[model samples]
Target: MADTILVLAWLVLAHLAADFILQSASIAAAKSGHGSRALAGLFAHGWIVAAVVVPVGFAFGERGWWFVLLTGLSHIAIDRAKVVLTRRAAAAALREAHDRHEAPRPPEHLGRAWTPQPAALFLADQGAHLAAASGGWAVLLAGVPLDPGWTAAIDGWLGSWDRVAVHGVASAAVVLIGLAIVNIRAASLFVGILVRPVEVTAGGEHRWGGRVAPAPDPDIRSSTSAAQAPVGRRWSIRLGPLDARVIAEPEPAIASPASPSTPPLGGSARVGSTIGVLERILIVVFVLTGTDVAIGFVVAAKTLARFRLLDDRDFAEYYLLGTLASVAIAIVSALIGRAALGALLA
Candidate 1:
């Protein structure tokens, strides 16, 4: 039974490693200006997980194999679940934005078919988890003892029953981390809204509305030279910036609240201001996490700046502060993950 579990775990780990790296790479690719280094690094993370598990499998023999397999499955399952949930949320948000006439121009490649980056990323994540679950189970079922008498070789490190406990803990930690990330993201969004207001006008009236932010630099529009024109309008077609309706409204009261009391964090924050704060936070977090923060940062800045969230120079400063906060959070998250893993395993 132990050997079977061990083999399964190793297989799952292998599948998960491949899936995560590929998913991360895909996400990095879809966003603009994410450097090759960042992309390569994301693609490399799976290798680290793989490296740690392979040797353990070899050392503990059957038991070790089962441990690795089970742990791997757990990792994959948690990640996959998170991806599914996140994707659903992102898709809903995108649909709402589109319906409300607030959707950004989809990059040329996306046209009407393009889904949000988060949805794509989540799908990739789900793929990795699915591979781990099915592949790991298959490998274990195929061979009774992944290695006959393999459990005796290294009684030193894992020491029998400890292997199962360790793996159980590790798997749990992975799931917890996924849950934490989702929560943090949601909390960050709420916090952002509490601090700023976006100025959205519907027709001629001021309608303060928050929007689904876009990436700062999206895949640029495709070159017209390569675009195949539709059959009918070839000669008489004129391509130019479409005329946007202009409306004038009274200058919104720029004055601070009379009592100078700041609202509680994340509640009733104005749309433009909220985006500004959110972008600043994300920029800082991205730098610290060394993750490719998406074009949401750029959109937030542009929208907020357009609505007078901050003057140009002040916006720059706000982003700088946001970076610092993100770095701190990244460190804390890492530490918490490490501790959580240790506790679960121990």
Candidate 2:
């Protein structure tokens, strides 16, 4: 049972590391595009998936190699399916909009509308890959004894350390690493989707400036009758395949002189993402160490740095939503890790 748990943990760790950490942004983008480049990127990512799992396979013996081969192929197949499905879904959405005589905006133009199809598809894709990993392990490796030679080598290397102790340590490490990966990378993707803003235009007015509070007001219709009228252009915020919310057009922003050109957003976005990653990591550490009270200091420091920006209602909402989500993910991951470590060591 211990061996099975350890091997499964390693399998999950490898999958997460390959899919999230090692896969380059360019490769991920290319995989979602057309032509031979897409195929090349897909294959490259598949190779990485296999490579990361090779150590586990090698340790497990000959059957492990076969497991590695099947996992790699399955990953490529799953990703290809996601790409095709996403394209078809996008096309169908555009067709539906055209049939209604509405001007169709591209998905990107939606500016991360709440629960967008792409984000749903991304979550589904990852879920499929993880399912494959767990299912493959159950089918191929469960109940099979660990390779004796591998165990003997590890024992020899550790000298006086008991094999069980080593396995416990290894399992703990794998669990912690997996939690860190999910808290940092996976949570970022999730929080971004959750905080996505849907743009609403009405009555042929295309005013597109100013940030609105993320939370929709229940009394918005009464408060802004002209803007909230049913007549005019509107878009649906999707929850998976369904339209979760249909926001009415909003009041126009007061026109002012065009502000000076700002720097490209790409750099700032990258910096913010990096900060978020660090913040989550620190939060996880605090939780695991039973220093939960220290988490307040971390949040305060982050908020203080962005205190001036928080004056903007839009920025404040975005910042608050993202911070809460990050903290939640970190806490949950840490708790899971703590439980797993306790089980392993006990």
When superposed on Cα atoms, how far off is each prediction in RMSD? Answer: 15.8, 12.8
Q: Over the stretch 5-100, how does candidate 2's per-residue lDDT look in tens digits?
A: 667677778988998899986787677666797799899999999999887676778878888999999999999987777655444443344345
Distance from true position, residue 153, model 2, in Å?
Answer: 3.4
The lDDT per prediction is: 0.40, 0.67
Ten contiguous residues with the weakest lDDT in model 1? 199-208
What is the total number of backbone clashes in candidate 1?
A: 29
Candidate 1 regions exceeding 4 Å error are 1-39, 55-124, 140-150, 157-346
Instruction: Kindly report which residue pairs in candidate 2 clash with one another.
Output: none
User: In model 2, what is the error at residue 141, expressed in angstroms?
Assistant: 1.2
lDDT winner = 2
Model 2 / residue 166 / CA error / Å: 2.8
